[model samples]
Target: MTNEEFLSKMQDVLQTEEELKLDTVLDDLAEWDSLSVMATMAFLDKDFGVKTTMKDYKNVKTIGDIAQKAGL
Candidate 1:
């Protein structure tokens, strides 16, 4: 998928109205909570066929990181 599509999906995953950029810090997002993590895990698996654990997020600091993981 393209980067724009990935970010659009992330907006849904995050349930946020704010626009997301590649460099947007995960920590800076109000929706960056446990629920969002779980949603993201499911999103990645369902959409990209990628599996991720909580440990994987330790190294993911931005929305771009998740896109990269999704192979975007």
Candidate 2:
């Protein structure tokens, strides 16, 4: 999927109204909690066939990081 689509869909995964950008830091979002992380894990697996553990999130700092995981 395109980067734009992925970013837009991430709002759903995050359940937030905030506009996300490639450089937007996940930690800066109030919605970027444990649930969001878990949802993101599911989203990646369901949509991109990518697998990620909680441990993987230590390296994920921004929206772009998740996009990379999705191969966007």
Candidate 3:
């Protein structure tokens, strides 16, 4: 998937159109709590077929990390 596609998917998962800049910190998002993490994990698995755990998320500090994982 492309970075744009990844961002779109993230927006959908996060349920916001609040333009996610690539450098935006995940923690900066109000919706980015544990539930959001689980949602993201599910999104990755369902959409990209990439299984991930909280441990995997520990290394992901930015939206770019998600894009990279999605092979953008």
Candidate 4:
């Protein structure tokens, strides 16, 4: 998917009105929580056929990190 589409989808996954960018820090978002992590795992699996576990998120710091995992 295009970067714009990924960002848009992330907005929904994060359940936030704040604009997301590749450089956006996940920890700074109010909606970035355990629930959002599950949503993101589902999003990646459903949309990108990528499998992920909680351990995978340990090193993830930015929105761009997730994008990379999705191969976007």
- The lDDT for every candidate, in the order shown, is 0.92, 0.95, 0.82, 0.96
| TM-score, cand. 2 vs. native | 0.97
Q: Comparing candidate 1 with candidate 3, which one achieves the higher TM-score?
A: 1
When summed lDDT is taken over every stretch of 10 residues in candidate 2, the lowest stretch is 1-10
lDDT of 4 by residue, 1-71 (tens): 89999999999998999999999999999898999999999999999999999989999999999999999
* Model 3: CA > 4 A from native: none
Kindly list the per-residue Cα lDDT of model 1 for residues 1-72, writing each as its tens digit.
788888888999999898999899999999898999999999999998999999999889999999889988
Estimate the lDDT of model 3: 0.82
- Which candidate wins on TM-score? 4
Model 2 Cα lDDT, one tens digit per residue, 1-72: 888899999999999999999999999999999999999999999999999999999889999999998888
lDDT of 3 by residue, 1-72 (tens): 667777888988887657886788887887777887888899988988989999898888888888778666
Candidate 1 — which residues are off by over 4 angstroms?
none
Ranking by TM-score: 4, 2, 1, 3
Each prediction's total of clashing residue pairs, residues at least 3 apart in sequence or on different chains, is 0, 0, 0, 0
Candidate 4, TM-score vs. the true structure? 0.98
Backbone clashes in model 4, listed as residue pairs:
none
Better of 1 and 2 by lDDT: 2
Q: Enumerate residue pairs that collide in model 1.
A: none
Clashing pairs in 2: none
User: Which whole-number lDDT from 0 to 100 does residue 70 have in model 1?
Assistant: 90
